[model samples]
Target chain A: MAYMKDDQRKKLAVDVTRNSKGATKYILITISVLFVFFMLILPLFSVIVNSLKEGLGFYLEAISTEYVLAALGVTILATVITVIVNTFFGIVASWALTKFTFKGKQFIATLIDIPFSISPVIAGLAYIMTFGRSGWAKPVVDWINDMLGTDIKIVFAIPGVVLATIFVTFPFISRELIPVLNAQGTDEEEAAALMGAKGWTIFKRITFPHIKWALVYGVILCTARALGEFGAVNALSKTRGETFTLPLEIDALYLAGSADSITASFAVSSILVIIAVIVLILRNIFEHKSKANREV
Target chain B: MAKARKFRGGRVIPGFGLTFGITIAMLSILILIPLASVLFQSFRLSPSEFWGIISMPNVKHAFATSIGCAFIAAVINSIFGIMLAWVLVRYEFPCKRIMDGVIELPFCLPTAVAGITLSKMYSTKGEIGGPLFDWFGLRISYTHVGLVIALIFIGIPFVVRAIQPVLEKLDSQYEEAAYILGASRRKTFFKVIIPELRPALLTGFGLAFARGIGEYGSVIYISGNNEKEHTQVVSYIIMQKLNYLEYESATAIALIMLIISFILLLFINIIQIRQSRRTNNI
Candidate 1:
């Protein structure tokens, strides 16, 4: 019996050694982890480290003047308007989506996803063709320009920039809100209504809590995308470097053959990185809480 | 309860009518209007003119390089993306959270920033690119090589993120069962895990490819975007036309890009439906 048991054990050991699978699996996994680790951090590291760089301070000095300041103000102004308009519409649309069902329901959902799927450059061209020199927007603009004698370059101006950003980011909020409302179920809202809650009261007390974190997530992502949007703005017209956003400013610097401006680009980018990290952490928290609550 | 039953007037789920109305209006303004405008403008161009435009040596080359390079990048990203997603989900290791954080960086950073940094680093005198150029003559900038690298950088995250969720949802029991039967891990993964991941993997690849096709920011920095068959993409060509105030030709090129994207999207959508049906049968 002892001899038989020893033979079996030896055979098992040989089988394990011959398989040679475990080592291969571990190696594959290690390579994957390292690849992601490097790709994600490397460029980010380049940006953050390069920002405070003393190597390229000369060019950074050139663009740090009032010109960039105006660009910064324009960026912030565009972002603020974008967020306000998107949020108002995003909420109303999400609410309407959650509150009622009508014809072309699926079609609408598909349409919202279009901005996400198509190229941002195409979006820029669309705005230009529809609103530029001989665009559909031309008549309105000519009317306004003739009446007020004020030039409104909606195709190249801040308003155009704002509109483009809005198109690019419109989906973020609704996409976030829909999933949360769908998952939360209607139990609470029905209960609130049963207690004589009006539409506003129910939304304020019951529905809002279910979706607040998702709203925040959507808002942060939208803000980031808007702040850094490039393709549309670049294609539309960057006639005046004075009107350049930080990103466009970076592109200009790169074009001008000054490498130091890269660092300043990273400095502003680091702020975005910090915001992204915070949002990710919040997402983790919200997800964990929801999962735990589901178990309870 | 069931799918159709869930839509029944429960008073709590909100009415379908209101949701449909707002959604359509929002979509029409945001998506349909913009896309249709491009098509409408393109209609002004004669067929001969559109064909003549595409036959131009420079335009033809840009289109070829853009399509060809985007494919290469998407393919490379798919392999890496699949491996990356698998590792993140299957293993518990030190700095796993940090790894997770890093995988998401591309999604967070501006494409322009990514482009600038990549272009600089790959320059002959730039940090990483310098040594590579010196040792192997693997010049990335002002070449098709550079365009591919930029697309790979911007595209990989989509594949990884898309696949990761599906990976996490997968049950580990299948792997365990294969192991119990003395099947090799390689066999188990290929036969069991990979089959399940096929749909998601393809979708991710399609998305990354589509993203690569539209790429403008990152590629512009790395690829000289010179009209000389060097790094110029179709989007750059369109920009040139627009810059020259040649609106009709610009719209024509854009219209071509639009159709290609739509066809590819349709192919993916069909595959998705088939995949869902197959899964339901299982």
Candidate 2:
């Protein structure tokens, strides 16, 4: 206690009053850390704790083995299909928007933001109302079922999940790519064409490289989003034993009131967090590289 | 710039043809079609009935709760975002990089995870929510308060990211000039610094507001939706309709929100444009 001299105490009081940047900075940093602790770190604590108990063995013994795996498979399948679909759509849309202008160019740019504004639950319901049991696509689905005889379904199944995820995630690739492409310009494309390099050749040699890193970053984000997709998937699919993603699995486990079953959900989330961290690090690298390039 | 290479009809550029054609098709199918479908479905009800459906106390409550909570959250963000950004820009501090990363958490963490985590923290037995409730009997879980906190969590980053760039872009000369004239730091900030930031601040506020209006996942767990009372939000109302097989009602609700969002965004744009013009005149 004596180590805190009267002079030192007076200096501390003076520092607080005059607003020493260091002391205030410490308070600000602490507040920020508290924010992160509340927001990012805490939720992760629960997930990590749960995941610890969920060995690959817990999954095998607890439930219907085939059903669980199929659910797992369906989740991956949906993520893959959605990523491919959205990436292609986003790329083409961005590429097209950059390379051309027409009567409604501004209108179309606004339209591209539709997915961002849309709630996933609404998006899911949109698909269902359009193509679910009492939908416009019902007859088409029925005809296919009749032709194929009973083993096929679209709504409330993997196909529906894929389509819904694709719809909800469309803006990712286009939003990232359009800006990069717009900045890149059409000079090279024109130059390549003048040299008779052809459309595909021009894209491969020039356009692709310019946008490749951003494309990867965007696609990774899109994929992570797809993996953790919940609201839309929840709306579309029922019968958790039949169709469930990792988040849905967690939802079901929580609702079923088994603390132990929650383990599977946590394990899946931990896996996703790991994947996301890797993707985010890559994104950060590309972003910093682009900034550096701009400075140059 | 060549008229010959412009590919006819006074088009801006040659590739415009292909781009326009593709963009229009994509927009029509993917964007316009779904939104239009929502409107078309909403029209399934008669005029008076549509009003009744939309103006139900439950629906109105949901709508109001969502708007009110979101507004509160956005206001908090506006204040905090500005302060946090100022701190980040103006000072050198320990673990400053970590502070930078923390702002982006609302962006990176999955919304579902956010919902679950926040609900646990604010429940009757958890850390902060529990302590506050124990002290004052002011519960956060399953209440309007919980809804706002959830929203504030998700909406903070939108404003912070938006304003951080603008703050960095401003010239510090005005602040110095004000200081030389003997203005207080507070007066200098309000006079010199804030006027420059108004347009950017408003734009960030608009984005955060728009984002809050559409937020669903984080709100749902904490909101404790009873359908007829305080907790239900517009997005959940849409979900409930989908659950009830009332497709028209669902679409109507979503369409209404979409229109409101459009108007808010348009208003923000107009203000920004006029402000920019005024500043240029100055």
Candidate 3:
């Protein structure tokens, strides 16, 4: 009778602990979900809501304005060019870093990550000092313009916008590619070389297949970053309607301080929000694909 | 001959010369040379001149506001980030995948968009701000409180992403052992689990802190940008200097920021390397 009573007591203790554990889990989940909602989801929701508050026609008209269109064009142009340049750099840098045994390799890798730590505003300022009038490179820039018989302004121009974008997005592709390539090793390439296969052939057949998904993943991230680049581009691009990217245009419209312009700012913001959502979805898909490839 | 041997050490694959040349050339033109200009520009000023610019009261106040707020934001992020990572890793909730995916929103979403939306939502007549003002009479937008909130938003992903993988790979055996040894649940979490998570947590805190210090776009809108001592951040000061065409002063401030960030990153890198080494040894 006493033994039975002790067993019952132990059973009750276990049940109590388990119930408390369950409560703790529920509480954690609730708090975490609420945090995400308030900090992230709700603000995104408000953007869309306020955007259409003046109705869809106004939203459409707001986004289709002449400056908005020009900003959109500039943004897309910068993103495309940045993507192309960074992709080429990514492939080469990752290949060199991973496939070869070289001194200062780690140093070089650290150097690539410099842009991530540096403020984008500083990045813009750096370019201005590098190429602006009275800069060290001014004579070189001027000579290039004179030799080509053309006016080519770098700072406060489209070239400056593209350069700033490139600076900020420099490491995304290579950072993604390096690890994937490192894990792949160079055994297959070595074997192919012994069999007298050319370098291009080896890469196309062996290495390319391994890194293709990661490359695309990197490119997507770079494109998203380039599209949204604000600070660096803000520093370099001066003429508002002529050189403004989407983010800058949104800033201008918001600061214009008219109620109509504020509403228009939200409308412009919705376009970026939509692009960001699409980028998020694509990022999720590619992230899974890359992880699955690594496991395979 | 020594160089040749070094090159031959891992030369099984071809195209080393071509690829390496391309890497160096592009890196110089794209990154290194441009950044060097900042250093060179700062050097144009005498040491006293550089000190005069950065040591101004307004400049010092901006740095203090930036660093102080970033530190607070990093602490908040560390606590909540660990919680979020824990919940995502250990719990099986509905829409969990979507929830996990949404954590990266701050990363991909344009900061200017985040800035405008956050500013609108936190303004006096805004949805969240309106309710709080009606009840507690608290104001958020254009205050120091609003600036920290913006920094927190910019920093959320860094901490969460850092902790997630570490939490995922943590072995359960240690926790089980702690429990068997009569340690309570909370005891096990703090003693056994937290020590294991320390490196990742520190890494996340460092990264978020660094990012918050230099944040510009998201902060400029919400921070009101009017109150110099209370709201102006370091990056805004750099912009202000540039607007005045004071390139030397701008570069001086930027160089300092660059140095601070590099140190933070270097510290994080060391922690990561040590963690990896320990994991490999195990």
Candidate 4:
């Protein structure tokens, strides 16, 4: 058989009908572009413009209030704790699921996916059922409170906020890592093991480098979810300004029914929108890198 | 014990037990305990009590509103999402990357933020819905239509993400062949392309449906939370129940929502499994 060169093969594979550029193609493309513009771009543009429409001074004033500042702090704190805890779990869970072929592996994988399916509001309710003042473990909590002679509020406090955020965002990092790790397999790690490298050493020298980009991508996703979490946070938050995260504050302000409060809500929303834009950009970069890696 | 031991495949890397232990421990503590508590609390109620909670008119209506609206939104999303994915994949356009990035804005943006944004836009005196209301007497804010719009906003990304890769990797030769064989473009698209994209479409539909059903943050603001009608959804009802210290009732509703969502996810999983099987066969 005669061999075809690369350029010839590529040219032959190109479909004449597809490149002929018919009217249907143009019509469909126009409809799609228009849909995306009206549905997505327009609303986003409205938010950004309205947010700054009150001018820079009003925007800054709205975001710089004590409650808003506190909400910002709580949001950052939650994101940090969520990222740290989920990263560890993501690494271990992905390693166990992919590197080891244990019984109930499929079950555990399904279990990890529970958070994604359940409502975040319901998740907050579950936490309250466990740790609220009238929760099942109330007696235990009271015992600890009496023992320590200290008042620690779990349900309506920072702890509850952190827990709900963790529950909602738990699957992001692990979900991202598992496919990448499974695709990578354990050949290199096993090879390193055979060469007498310790477990940590092998992980550091081998697995870390391969999955680092994925890890960053997962962490970024986890951070975004943590920052944006609302339903669970809302259910658990007393909204007393002390326990309010940024989303909670935004909701509170929006519902406050004042001209100033409405503008303030827009300002806070603009902050979240800014964070979202950053996440979107980072995701694009990582997605491109991962696609390149896969092609290679 | 021997059968269980046999399931562990041969791997020379160390820390299997350590990783396994951490995984199980964290999973149990962080996920299982909280999830199980909902079931446990629901079980604490008598069967009749459970029935009473779930069968109440309000409860029934909330469920109907959420599931019904989400279904409608998912259908709309499937259509527009396919179109969006096709445009992004097939055409060479300016700001394509920007368009792709913005599609994911909902996934990262706080739903509360989205809720306010939508409510503001669609409010009776607002920019978009103001003219909408004045010209047509369309009261979108605090209406079922608003709720569906919010659901669609959050749901669009799922369908787009799900279908984009499938369209990108789709070979054009098959379409060309169909055309050459005297099949019209419409026929080729409906016959050939639709079948190829069906699984992804279904999976995306289910995902968007599940997400819409479980959604609370965005819908709460615009849903009006009206006790007069069925504007309230199951998640909002659950929050209301909790607010009144009705733990058992909240758990009961949550358990039901969880069960429905689980079935939806299971359906998606089955689709994915079959998809992988088909790919493996190919």
Q: RMSD for all candidates, in order, please.
A: 6.0, 7.3, 5.6, 2.9
Q: Which stretches of candidate 2 lie over 4 Å from their true place?
A: A1-27, A50-68, A140-152, A194-196, A261-268, B1-15, B179-181, B227-229, B265-282
Candidate 1 residues B107-173, lDDT tens each?
6567788888888777897777889899998787777887888888888877887788777766555
TM-score (0 to 1) of chain B, per candidate? Answer: 0.92, 0.90, 0.94, 0.95
Candidate 1 local lDDT, residue A139: 94
Once fitted onto the true fold, the runs of candidate 3 whose alpha carbons sit more than 4 angstroms away are: A1-20, B1-10
Please identify which of the two predictions, 1 or 2, would achieve the higher lDDT against the true structure.
1
Candidate 3 TM-score over all chains jointly: 0.94
Each model's DockQ? Answer: 0.47, 0.31, 0.55, 0.61
Residue-level lDDT of model 4, residues A148-182, one tens digit each, is 99887889899899999999998888888887887
lDDT per residue for candidate 2 within B19-132, as digits (tens), equals 556656766765566566666666777888788788988889888888888889889888878877877766556766656655765665666666766775788865667898
TM-scores (chain A) of the candidates: 0.80, 0.82, 0.92, 0.92
Worst 10 residues of 1 chain A by lDDT: A9-18
lDDT of model 1, residue A279:
58
lDDT of 2: 0.71
> Per-residue lDDT tens digits of candidate 1, residues A79-179?
88888777766777777765554455544555566666667788889889888876776798889999999988778888788778788777878877876
C-alpha TM-scores of all predictions: 0.87, 0.85, 0.94, 0.94
* lDDT for each candidate structure: 0.73, 0.71, 0.89, 0.86
Clashing pairs for predicted structure model 2, backbone only: A100-B16
TM-score of chain B of 4: 0.95
